[model samples]
Target: MAVTTAPDRAATPVRAPAHRVRRRPTAWIFAGPAAALFALFFAYPLGASLLQSFTAEDAGSTRWVGLDQYRRMIDDPVFLKSLVNTGAILIVQVPVMIGLALVLAVLLNQSWLRFRGTWRALYFLPAVTTLVAYAVVFQVLLKTDGGLVNQMLGGVGIGEIDWLNSPTWARISLILSLTWRWTGYNTVILLAGLQAIGKEQYEAAAIDGAGTLSTYARVILPQLRPIVLFCVITSTIGTLQLFDENYVLTKGGPDDATLTPVLYLYRIGFQQFDFGYAAAIAWVVVLLIAAVSALQYLAFGRERRR
Candidate 1:
């Protein structure tokens, strides 16, 4: 047969496998645009902001001042007040919201709970609501004269108190609004963590003669450390970055009572046109967030090595 006279192996021209194409160029082809965009937008802006922070504008000219901007923050009363306000919210609002969320989570996780999905959605609605609309509604509700909240208080014989005008009441209003908006979100997260735990563990605790509250405190909550830590860390960070709610509601205040770092940054950068100082403040906030988040991780992330 003619097949018996097949061409010699070496003499047969080698055809490179079609599938053996170089992949490196293809990867770069896909990644090059994204890389370029990131460099242009994120990287350039970050480096520029950092460089600008070390320089001060003099006689309409930029001159390097080397830490002068950072030093300014130390003695700036508005800046210090902003820090204090942020700290207060971090300490008070975060714990209260988290505690309420934990309670709601446990209650919502109960097997007897009716229309659980509906309840969960209802609770979470505030989180997904339009920010502008939410802000406007809150403004109307918190208005000093003839507001919804004031009218309600008046009906109850509680004299009309300025909800958003007085510094103390403004802070309180901010905290209450923050809690109202975020507590449900945290509740959903904690509830997810609770549900992930099987009923078998609950039964195991029951067999060990543990009461319901003790069961949760001793058995369940211990396992939920990671989730709780997540909530706390996020809430802490959010408090640090607080601006929108305070801005929309109080414009950072009657007396800067709710003026957070970011809102302060806005004022410094935009209103005052002190971009270098603002950049310094921004970097400080970034560092503070990193430090606080690390500390919280160490504090709440502890677990027995198993």
Candidate 2:
């Protein structure tokens, strides 16, 4: 009887599992539109930019220059100045902002803090505020005459310091604006990192007779290293590509003291109409960012392994 049933096995149709059939098309259906849009927008533009970087284009002609643009970039005084300016800001601003953010995050994480929510919102307000609006407000507040900051200084029997005219002060003003706008964002991130740390570790440290400074140094800082690395890398990239605040507030003024890589790229592309050179500059910036990110990641990995 069993052998008889086997005779019909060749004609039997096997069916796919119901869940397999259902899931087969689910990913495509949900992700298809997003994939299409990303290809259309990001991929296409990035490819075009890469291609354009190698080709010199004029009003009526186009030709491949192979690295000529890059060579020119090396000799461009404006580009050099922009690089120096951006490097200065990156070296100074990132460390200061990260330290301040870490301090603020620690302070805010205390459970007994009063008006905690209000304080968090207040600190984060500048991040959400419109760039132009805040920049304008700062411009007005730091104005040479009758500005609020100067008025307050006068009332306090202090001389009204020049906020934007002098080169050093212009750089200071730019850094201050960037710190005010971005410090809260970094603090929020660090606060989240601080919260993710298990309370048991702190309890263990306390049981070991670790003081407040010892607990933070030995227990908390080690765990927070990855988050700190993330903040540093992102802040480095942002500082390297800085444009908006300098453009709106200082316009790279005081003899180009605040000129950044992105502003230089914008001037090359839009102002000078040298699309090929601009594309090359953009690629250089991208490569520099990638190298710095890789170095940071490698350093983190080495520390972790140790």
Candidate 3:
């Protein structure tokens, strides 16, 4: 009995000092600031936006109107046009930009490529350039009459294009501008993912008589799945919220062909002072983005798990 009692006492845990044993308080101290910041910045604004979306503007006073604003949004032809344009951007521009970025990243990752650092710096320059600067520069360059781009085209016997004043041309111009600005950023991100892939895999593929294209398609692409998914989701959301370029360059002009949800929302809230309708539009845009992002995650996340 004494021997058994001694073994049991030794097996029991002994309480240590608070400084030596306690981890809960230290964790809370480290996490408290970030938790408070998130609540103030993200959580509060989201709640406010959702609430405001359900309200109405009556003689400068906001009154709760339930789903009237939402129903109005469903009937707004202008909003529908903006949504269509935003969808066009996603369907067209995002893939082009990402594809170009992948090609550039592969070329830059080559050990034998000369002046690689300089090339990378040149490519990445536009991403760090101010948004306003890019808009202003492109606006000048792409001017329909006596512009640099048209002048160059004329040298090859092509006539001047009314880039911003024409509906099709305006959409094309925005897409090209966005691609040029963001492709470099995507390239840098893809390059980081490419670098993380093991050199051994490439060597092994080469030993098996695989060429560069074959190796990239089979090995490199598979490893880049996560990075590609991330880029797709981010670019989708950004394109859906398209506003700045349309505002600065076209003002959703050429008969509203270039209008985006965000631009429409801005016009309603800030320009017209119809905060209730704008809030409703903003919420609709958010829901669209969330739905698309969720779909992408579900598709990619399932593939990753397998």
Best by TM-score: 3
Candidate 3 residue pairs in backbone clash: none
Point out where model 1 deviates above 4 Å: 1-21, 302-306
Give the top-scoring candidate (lDDT): 3
**Backbone clashes under 3 angstroms, per model:** 0, 0, 0
Candidate 3 lDDT tens digits, 1-306:
455434686779988877865887888999999999999999999889889989987887889999999999888999999999989878999999999999999999999999999999999999999888899889999998888999999999999999999999999999999999999999999999999999999999999999988999988898999999888898898899888888888999889989999999999999998888898898888889999999999999898788
In model 1, the worst 10-residue window by lDDT is 297-306
- For model 3 the TM-score comes to 0.91
Query: How well does candidate 2 score on lDDT at residue 187?
Result: 94
- Candidate 1 lDDT score relative to the true structure: 0.91
Q: Candidate 1: deviation at residue 280, Å?
A: 0.4
Task: Write one digit per residue (lDDT tens) for candidate 1, span 83-145.
Answer: 999998889999999999999999888879999999899988998986667877888998889
CA error at residue 70 for candidate 1, angstroms: 0.6
